[model samples]
Target: MKTLTYVSTKSVNDLTWPTTYDNTNIYSSALSVLTDFQTAGPRVIESNTRADELVQLMKKEHVRMKIVVDTHNHFVGVISLEDLSEDVFIKQVAEGYKRSELMVADLMRPKETLLALSYTSLKNSDIESLLYSQRENTLQHLLVIDEGTKTIRGLISSNDIVRQLRLDVDVAFSSFEHTYHSAILGQKFQSRSLKVA
Candidate 1:
């Protein structure tokens, strides 16, 4: 056995906080904003969870989105705080379903209808170009796929990008469609105006 020496804590005044890439502008690399699952685990929820319960849990945990999984933990879909909003539940109630009977799978964006960006492509791009390319997509959260491993690598959130870059754009909570039209399209238009000026 080797002898080990213990250091004194007398001089330690502060703890080092972990830091991510500083995304101070739109030109920052797209990878900088990715919530890589390999590093930080994805927030997930079960498909059979109650919608109202999920809303309360999300609010309490301060989580805005969660990857939905089946009982076997297989990826099934994704659900955002917006997915469990009052209007959505009300719509289901109109369709003859009881409010308390709604499940997360009912409102989640199913995997079949989702699209993802390849990790390789994202690594070579910047935030501005990425957003410009996705201007036509009605997405608030974008998944990143690892083509080589054939697995989900991570995700990017429009809200995170907007916050990190401090963009003067509003991502309305009314609906994902409205957010796409107003925020993404607005960015595209803003860029065009800047070029003209």
Candidate 2:
């Protein structure tokens, strides 16, 4: 029999967490800000999940969006915190549907209405270029597609960009659309500063 040695925990005061790319500068690869499904699994929910349940889960996890899937786990659509806003629920209730009966699919952005960027293109781009290209759009989350594999690869969130770059703008009280616009504006100012230096 072999005996295993145990280390003392008394002196260990710090915990280690996983880290991604060390260089988070604007010129760094756009992938640095992406939540890659290949590396970290995508956040998903079943289409039939109750709206209230989805809201609770999102709030508890501090996630603003989730990919909607079917029983077979195929991506069908996406749902965001904005989609389940109190206003939307109130409107639905006014239309005669009970709150308890609402499902995620009822408010999700269908797959047909969504757009995705090619993984190949994202790999060749930098954060500055990516933000510049998407400056006019209000989409909170941009999905990445691996066209060659015919699969959903990952997503880039406006919040993630704001956090990763340590931007001065506060996103907590801002809507996703506002946050996206703010991030773009912040990036532009930063780019100009870099040029002036």
Compare the candidates by TM-score and give the number of the best one. 2
List of clashing residue pairs for candidate 1: none
In candidate 2, position 128 carries an lDDT of: 76
Q: How would you encode candidate 1's per-residue C-alpha lDDT over 1-197 as one tens digit per residue?
A: 99999999999999998885563556778888799999999999999999889999999998788999999988999998878888998899999999888899999999998989999999999877787777666667889999999888999888777767655557444223443445567767989999999
Q: How many clashing pairs does model 2 include?
A: 0
Off by over 4 Å in 2: 1-7, 11-14, 20-23, 173-197
Candidates' C-alpha lDDT: 0.82, 0.85
Q: Write the per-residue lDDT of candidate 2 for residues 1-197, one digit (tens) a residue.
A: 99999999999999998875555877889989888898899999999999988999999999888999999999999999989999999999999999999999999999999989899999999887788777666667889999999999999987787777776656654333554456667657888999999
Estimate TM-scores for all models.
0.80, 0.85
Error of 2 at 158 (Å): 0.8
Query: What is the TM-score of candidate 1?
Result: 0.80
